[model samples]
Target: MDCDVLVVGAGAVGAVAALGLRRQGYRVRVLDAGQPMEAPTGEAIDPRVFALSPASIELLESLDLWPRLAPRAQGYAGMTVWDAVSGSDIRFRAAEFGLDGLGAIVENAALVSAAQAALDDVEFGAALAAVDETTDAVTVTTDDGRPVRARTLLLADGANSPGRQALGIAVSGRGYGGRAIVCHLRSERGHDVTAWQRFLPSGPVALLPLFDGRVSLVWSADDALADRLLALDDAAFSDAVTEATAGRLGALHTPTRRFAFPLRRQTAERFTTRRCVLLGDAAHVVHPLAGQGVNLGFDDLRALLVAMPDPDVGLRAAALRRYERARRADIAQMSQGIDGLDRLFSTANPAVSTVRGFGLHLADVVTPLKRRFAEVALGVKPGFPSASG
Candidate 1:
């Protein structure tokens, strides 16, 4: 099989990348080892949810998907973040940035469904076995003994991308020494469509609002503490979560089965090798305290689409090089910012805590600076890609 672009990994990012490229008039083919996403059996929200930035929403809108997802998505007009250690807090509002909402929270499955629906075909159950890049095309061998070739191969296989490894790419990563425990819970008080986060010595705890009036909880805990928390019964876990949030939303109860994953800061040494390029977690994976992991992926698609606006010309070395240079700076900046925040908040030093708290307080009071910060987080920037780009 051959195409203008071969996208390996049909996850949300990979699927979106393929669809986006196809929209740009590229003959794109997607290969994935994962099963097709199943429709939700009921109205119960999936435990995994992503905070979709305005940029991401725009990208989805360009594909005519936001309308389908809007009914199920929960939009937050504001966010409040505070430090548990120093009791300092900062608040951000969409109104401050002249936007109706900061972002929308949508389930992972929902996004996959939306992106997948936009695509005409995705080769499910197709695991990559080998990748061989030639002077003209990247040839791939599937696990089932099939050969495929393309002018450009996109490796969106995720943080541990086999496609990246096949190209001898290296990654630098360090564990945050914490695990995030995620679940959905009902609160005694309304969430008021606000996303809340509190930084503790261990990690940050976020309570993101949902459309159904429940909140999604993301508690990043130290490994030992996470173990203990995971061992607790459902009621006990709910009690702990309620206490952790300081009962801000009143009491949180009826938590769904909790999910925990180790947190890490990872980035590939390079984003491109020959005709194969990395996207999403394949290129970078940062601490999730900011909930920008997937958003960064969308930006990857955006940058690629912008740099290589013409498919025929996009497969060239110059276009690939342009894409590499375009995305690296933004990815690096975000990676550093998240890494710095993780390290800063994880520090137990009293002096650092005081300084951090003071900084938060100062930012809260400084209107222009606060708006700038909000804009940055919303993924609206000077070089953001338009639908045409």
Candidate 2:
């Protein structure tokens, strides 16, 4: 098999797909733009972090990638959500969901490295130049000059996937007028092995507990404020963080590595095109309010492998219709949910606050409903998977 599955973008999603696909008895090849030119491979830690769903953990565990990630990753028992203005709060625990841990707070670099190291088959440093879907198969070319054909092409190149565009997939994007400013901060108080998200008018400020006495923070704010915060000195930064989060984590001090990215709601017009399928960020990118972006990608990885044929497409129509149909509701629901949350807490009006706070209060008082909510938010509950129906 020259190429059983060709994956574009060797990021965490692409690496995981390559490993999982190869292990499922499919030959796989991966291509990346060679971040080595801009970022040293030795110190290649993606500043962004991810919250691995429990199902995602199971998949990683089965693939033997979890153990490799465990050393560099930190596990959280639960998360707390609050309002920066009104202080309306809701807490979800692993125990409430009948799980040992709510989820894992993993550095993006750690997951990428674990995913990469777990794969023995991949072609890094090769950015994709072209993707053509023929009558029978898909052909891919790389910048460093490597061409391969696979019966099925997996587009994991991320939100700005050029391969997706080259294949003429109409990707529509909508922005929330916000940016995610991320950095780590040393804490005086224990994050108590817990994750925290406070919804403010600017955006959300999440404090995910890390190894040692520190936490990784992603402060999504209006674009202008995010730019100014990124430029603040260490003392000013910490002071702002303390005030914004209501000093819950306590005595915050900004750690090294500060960065920001535009926030948006974008999805491809078609998730699958003939022999080509888009997965991971290539398919959709939503607000990081839920932190389910990569977990959603992992779900795709699992479903695609489960839906693959005995060998390859091999005159088969790829069964991608089944994949698309099975996954659409879940994707649509989540996209809308995130958009609603973005709007809910982003307005500065008092009427909006009162209504939203009352809703949160009602949710807090409702026991069974709250448990169900925890199950979904913490990624413990079995979701509507592409293979479920």
RMSD of each: 2.0, 2.9
Which regions of candidate 1 fall more than 4 Å away from where they truly are? Answer: 368-389
State the TM-score for model 1: 0.95
Residue-by-residue lDDT tens digits, candidate 1, 1-389: 38999999988899999988888999899999988885443567888899988778888998887887888799988899888888888888776666666789999888887777778589999998899988889999999999999999999998889998888999988998889999999999999999998888888899999989999999999999999999999889999988888899999999888899889989898998768889999999988888998999998998899877877689897888888998889888887777777777777689999998887889799976565555444454423334332
C-alpha lDDT values of all predictions: 0.85, 0.77
lDDT of 2 by residue, 1-389 (tens): 35767778878788888887777677677777755212213333456878887878878887888887786667887788888666798887677556677778877777786677666545667788888788678888877667788877888889989889899889777887878888878887989988898999888889887765578888888879988898889899988988888899788985667888888889888888888888989998888888888988887877776777445442255577777775778778777777777788887789889887887787688877665555445545623222232
Give TM-scores for every candidate, taking all chains together and pairing residue i with residue i.
0.95, 0.92
- In model 2, what lDDT does residue 36 have? 23
Assess the local accuracy of residue 173 in candidate 2 as a C-alpha lDDT between 0 and 100.
73
Which whole-number lDDT from 0 to 100 does residue 19 have in model 1? 85
TM-score of candidate 2 to 2 decimals: 0.92
